[model samples]
Target: MVLMQAEKTAIGSICFLAGPFTLLENALVLGVIAATATLRRRPTYLFIASIALADVFASCFFTTSFLDFHLFRQSDGPTAYLFKLGGVTMAFTSSVGSLLLTALDRYLCIHQASSYKVLLTRRRALLCLLILWSVTIFISFLPLMGWRCPTGLIPPCSRLFPYVNHGYLACWTSFTLVLLTLILCAYALILLKAHRHETSMTSLQGAAGTGHARMRMDIRLARTFGLILLILVGCWLPALSFMLADVFVILTHTQQRAFAFCSTLCLVNSAVNPLLYALRCRELRVALLQLLQRLCVIGRCKKTTQDLPPGIHFTEEISCTAITEHEIPTNGTMQLHSVSEMVNN
Candidate 1:
C-alpha cells in the first residue's frame, strides 16, 4: 500500500511539472504566429491558432487536476468533482473539437478550391470556433444536473459508480468515435483529390507546371494533417479503449496505473502540435527563427532575408527574373550598334 501511494505521488509530481512546460511551449508558438503579420493574415493559420489556444487551456486544466489532488491535498469533494468533470473533460473535448475544425478547414480548401476563400471566410471560421466552445461547454456541464455521484456515494469522490462513470464514458466515446470517423473520411477525400490532380496535370501544358506546384502544396499540407491525425489517434485511442473497458470490467490496481499513464499520454498530445508546426511548415519555421533572432538566442546581429515567407520571396523572384529577361540587353555589340545608328540618323 505504501509503495502504491508512492508510485501515485511520483506520477502526480511528473504531471505537475509537465503542465507548466507544456503551457509555455504552446504559448510561445501562439506568440510567434500572432506576432507575424503574414501568419496572422492567412485563413488556415486561424485554425492552427485555435488549436494552440485549446492546447493552452488543456495544459492549464490538466495542471490544475494534479495540483488540486496532490500538492493541495484536497479531498474528493466539490473541488475534485470540478476538476474531474469540469477541467479534464472540457479540455479534452475542446482540443478534439478544434482538430475536427481543422480537418473540416482542410476539406473545404480541397473541396472548394475555386471558391474556398468565399466558403471559409474569416467570419465563418471564427463562428465555427465559437460554436465548438459553446457546444463543449454545454456538454461538459450536463453531469452537474444529475449525472454526478449519487447521494450515497458522496464524499471520497466515487469515480467508480456505474452511472457516473458510464455517463462520462458514453458521451466522450461517442463524440470521439464520430469525430475520428469524419476526420478519416475527410483525409481520404483529400488524398483522392490530390491523386486525381496529379494524374490530370501530366497531360496539360503551361498549366501543368502550375498544377504541379499546386500538387506539391497539397501534398505538404496533407502530410502535416496526416501526422496530426496519427498523433491524435496514437495518444488517445489506447486510453479511450481502456476507459471503454472499465465500463464492462473492473480495472485492477495495475490496470488503474496503466489508465493514468495513458491519460497522461493524451495530455501530451496538446504539447506536440506546436512542435509539428515548427517541423513541417516553412513559414512557421522562418517566423520562429526570426523570433529567436530578435530574442538574441541565435547571436546574430543582422536579420536573415531568407527567413521571409514563401509568397514574398516568390514575388521577388518573379520580378527579378522578368527584369533580367526583358529589360537588360544581352549583347554589348548590339546595344552599341543601335545607339550608333540612332546617333548617325
Candidate 2:
C-alpha cells in the first residue's frame, strides 16, 4: 500500500508538470493560426486551430481536476466535481471530433482534389465546428443534468465510479470508438488513393520530369497521414479499452492505477499534436517563427533579423515574399504550398 501511494505520487507530479507544457504548446499553435491570415483562410488549418483550442481547454481542465482528485483530495461538492469532469470530457471530445474533421479534410483533399474547395468551404467548416461543439457539450454535461449516481451514494461518490453514470460512459466510449474507426477508414482510403496515383505516375512517366514532383507530394502526404494515424491509435486505443472495461466490471486497485496512467497518456497526445500537425507544415512553421520574432521585437530584444537561425531566416524571407506576391503554388488544391515548392526548388 505504501508502494502504491508512492507510485501515485510520482504519476501526479508528472501530470502536474505536463499540464502547463501541453497548454503552452497548444496555445502557441492557436496563436500562430490566429495571427497568420494565410492559415486562417484554409480549411485544414481551421480544423487544426479547432484541435489546438480544444487541447488548450483540455490541458487546463484535466490538470486542475485530475490533480485535485488524485493529489489534493479536497472535497468540492458533487456538483462542482461533476462540472469539472464534464468540462474535461467535453474538451477531449471536441479535440477528437476536430481530429476527425481534419482526417476528412485530408481525405477530400486527395480524393476530390479538383472540387475539394467547393465541397468544404470555410463557411461549411465553421458550421461543422459549431455543430460539433454543440453536440459534445450536450453529451458531456448529461451527468450534471441528472444522469449521475443518486445523492444517497456512499463516500466514493466523488470519483467517476459512482459520480458519473455507467450508461454515459458506455455510450461515450462507443461514440469515440466509432469516430476512431471512421478516422482510420478515411486515412486508409487516402493511402490507397495516393498509392494508385504513385503507380499511375510511375507507369506513365517513367524517369520523367514533373511526375517526380507529384510523386514526392503524394509520398509526403502519405507519410504525414500515416504518422497521424499511428499516434491516434497509440494514444487513444488503450484508454478507450480501459474505459469500456470499467463500464462493465469493477476495477481492482491495480486496474484503477493503470486506468489513471492511460488517461495521462491521452493528455500527452495534445502536447505532441502541435509538432505533428502544425509545425510540420512549412507555411505554419514559418508563420510561427515570424510570430515569435515579432514577440521578441515587442519585448525590446536586441536580436536582429540577421541574428536569427540559418534556415529560419531564409525560410521566413521566402514565406514573406510569397505571401506578399501571392505566388505560393497550390498545384490545383486548396491546401498551402508544399515545402518543396515553397523553397522554389
Instruction: Supply candidate 2's per-residue lDDT for 332.
Output: 19
The lDDT leader among the candidates is 2
Question: In candidate 1, how many Å is residue 28 off?
Answer: 0.8
Model 1, 1-345: lDDT tens per residue? 112566667767767776877799878878988899988877677778877887888898877765565446555764356547565677778877777777787778878989998888878888888888898887776666555655523332233322354656666677877877787888788888877776666556556477767678778867866887789789888887877776666666677667666777766888787776444678888898898766673333124335533343232322222343354565434555654555566
For every model shown, the clashing-pair count is 0, 0
By summed lDDT, the worst window of 10 consecutive residues in model 2 runs over 152-161
**Model 1 quality (TM-score):** 0.72
TM-score of each: 0.72, 0.80
For each candidate, the alpha-carbon lDDT, in order, equals: 0.69, 0.80
lDDT of 2 at 233: 86
Cα lDDT tens digits, model 2, 1-345, are 112677768878778788899999889899889999989999899999999999999899988888777777666776887899899999999999999999899899989999999999999999999999999999999988988877523332322344766677788999999998999999999888987887787778776765768768777877887888888889999889887887766666677777778888778888888888788889998998899877865555334335644553243433332242244454213223443454465
